[model samples]
Target: MTVYRPPARKRLTQDERRAVYERCNGHCAYCGFELETMHQLHVDHVIPMEFYELYEVEGYDLDSMDNFLPACCSCNIYKHTYRLEKFRAAIERMPDVLQRDAATFRHAVRFGMVEIKQHPVVFYFEATGVDVPSLHWDAEIEKKYRTGEQK
Candidate 1:
């Protein structure tokens, strides 16, 4: 797996950051903790930024609204440059991590941050050799979101 490094660029303006927080209901997308009570909140890329550089020849807009999510400091640090599948696997192996991240893990699945496939129903992160049960999503729903036809 590649480590995603965000490009050096202007940071999101206060208004833009505020919009993301509001969109996520002022809670950490992964943990659902109220942002107001937390010492800090981080704006995260749902898809690792490194993925864009590695796969997209046209370049990806890392600052796009659809790619951003609100996360608490711990969640942000814990997630680091992991792809969603890897992050989910890590959460599952550790009881405390799972307890703190279950809601967010389910949210990622439902929202299509993590890909789902049937077959043997296993998810594997090649870099880390972590495997876990597959999460499911409605393909049509995910397509709608990906195409900007639905929020």
Candidate 2:
């Protein structure tokens, strides 16, 4: 039996990493959070490598300096392999999701401990007009899917 393996990802050189870090001036491209330490930063692929097959069709470099962004750990973890617009949509739905799922969140809103503001989901890169690719690699999900755990 052949075991499925994800496509190999390229490791960025020190210079490459530096360039990505400076892309957003040491801030997260998604949330604009200042990253004080390099270790706290994650180099994100604008167009994730998981969609390697789309690179040719999309006419964008799948792996290159032009396709990288500087992201804080929180933003990177949250983005988590979603297309840019999809991530924005997910963020836009946060209030509703919280209200429906989190009792504490709903109680906080009721008591004025939390306020849900209405606004478009505008990312830092988008606000600054810095181009960032919208881009999922989910290993556990893939495994579950292959095993018929996911419908």
Candidate 3:
């Protein structure tokens, strides 16, 4: 099978990147981790650009900033080319996936070393009531994330 390589992504300038960063108040949109440095942050595409090539969708600008969501390095890497919903579903299934594939995780759970919190996968952006489709970020909105508020 021939692999289709998507075109290069447009690079955002510092100001543009700052805007994206501020979208989640310097937090990962998926995991809600406070991003410390620019190098550690990733602007993930809410709808992967690969979808445009896969489905041959025309007139849809997948590269537009409207599809951008600030993410930490891990979240961006894990999310990969999955669309938002698929990514969410994958996150929801991670415990099952880990329990099946990772002996360490399974052992930890079995021995009461790890406690799995079963709940729907809610992205940070979703929890913050951010308008994801429009890519709107309300900087004024306060976030009570697990890691605690930003100092």
Candidate 4:
């Protein structure tokens, strides 16, 4: 029952950005693309900040290090304000998007970094206290990979 909006601050300080890049090992969280090879890389909110504001929840800070992830230009642009599940679903449905970044998507799935759930989507990162119904992914697709059908 909430409308999504883009984050207000589009750029991070050089130090902040550098820290995130180093923390993520210079690789995109969504696509695993190397930052060195890409012309631009973005710092993405793992659990979008829009959700935090919409819900007016407690203890969720979007600017914190725990919530940040390195993302390549393509993935960041495509992701926009969609939640993790919605973004992952887009990767699965779109051939062009998937063809280049399936490995990263699969890796996130394998490691439980991203989850699939229906209805009001919520991705809870325990460390960050991010529990909100703003992100989404398909449980069926997750099952396919978990069962080794898609692997």
Candidate 5:
């Protein structure tokens, strides 16, 4: 979706992804990929506070750096939103969605747990006008987090 920044969600003091790596020992909580060895890494919001209807980060803002993390491309795409309740309902009967390697209050994304389809995530790119796909999210995310690049 189109991420609308109201000047507040626009910036942060320190590097978010680097911080997450330090916080989580360079391991993606979702995919458990070690950033130390990974070619590219992504810093994603554990809870998507930036609401969206079709495009843009809208509605109530919860732009906290603590919500960010170092995640693999797969996990970040799957755990895109904070509406875990809806996910629970959507993937209900599939006990796999309920299973987590570790407990997370708002975000418990385990990468490679399920074969997350690309269609749903492709909607976000279309809405946001971003060209990055699941295959390239890692590189794209790293660029954004490290050097503040957006395309």
Candidate 6:
């Protein structure tokens, strides 16, 4: 998979943003939120930028948007680190692959929706500037615009 680093925003424009949205079908790939509903529009790396920073720090490609994935804020938050074990155990059991899929994690583990209270963790991502998933693991199958399957 090609590695991707977000280029300076100044280097991009509306067309690029639209391209991203179109690539993702203008919906949050993780939570399946409609794009029109959320005013926020931004390209998300399916993998977090931080991870690539680590890889680049160790010497690797730092600019590959191929790994990018579009997502809404809520989905992004849930996917990033929205792990609440007790709560998760309480909800409808998550499928094995879904459990590993970050996109499904938040919807499954964030709020007591699945069961535990994650106010502190949720608030942390909120309080900090971080938002939805912009990247995904390079090895991950990326959404190919036509199929729901990640490839």
Worst 10 residues of 2 by lDDT: 132-141
RMSD score of candidate 4 (Å): 14.0
What total of clashing residue pairs does each candidate reach? 0, 1, 0, 3, 3, 20
Could you tell me which 10 consecutive residues in candidate 4 have the lowest summed lDDT? 131-140
Taking all chains together, the TM-score of candidate 6 against the true structure is 0.42
lDDT tens digits, residue span 29-101, model 3? 9999999987777988887877656323333456767778899998999999886778889999999899899
Query: Could you tell me which residue pairs clash in candidate 2?
Result: 82-135
Full candidate order by lDDT, most accurate first: 3, 2, 4, 1, 6, 5
Off by over 4 Å in 1: 1-6, 37-39, 96-151
Q: List the global CA lDDT of all models.
A: 0.60, 0.76, 0.78, 0.62, 0.47, 0.48
Candidate 2 versus the native: TM-score?
A: 0.79
Writing each residue's lDDT as its tens digit, candidate 2 over 27-130 gives 89999999897877798876666676645444455677766789988778877887677778888998999999999999999999999997898889878878
Model 6 spans > 4 angstroms off: 1-11, 57-63, 81-151
Best candidate per lDDT, number? 3
* lDDT (tens digit, per residue) of candidate 4 on 1-151: 9866645754677887887777546777666677894336687877666666633334345556666777888888888888776876776666444435788876776798866443432222332343322232234344655888732
Candidate 3 clashing pairs? none
Candidate 2 Cα lDDT to native: 0.76
Candidates by TM-score, descending order? 2, 3, 1, 4, 6, 5
State how far residue 41 of model 3 sits from its true place (Å). 1.2
TM-scores of the models, in the given order?
A: 0.55, 0.79, 0.78, 0.54, 0.41, 0.42
Cα deviation at 29, candidate 5, in Å, is 1.2
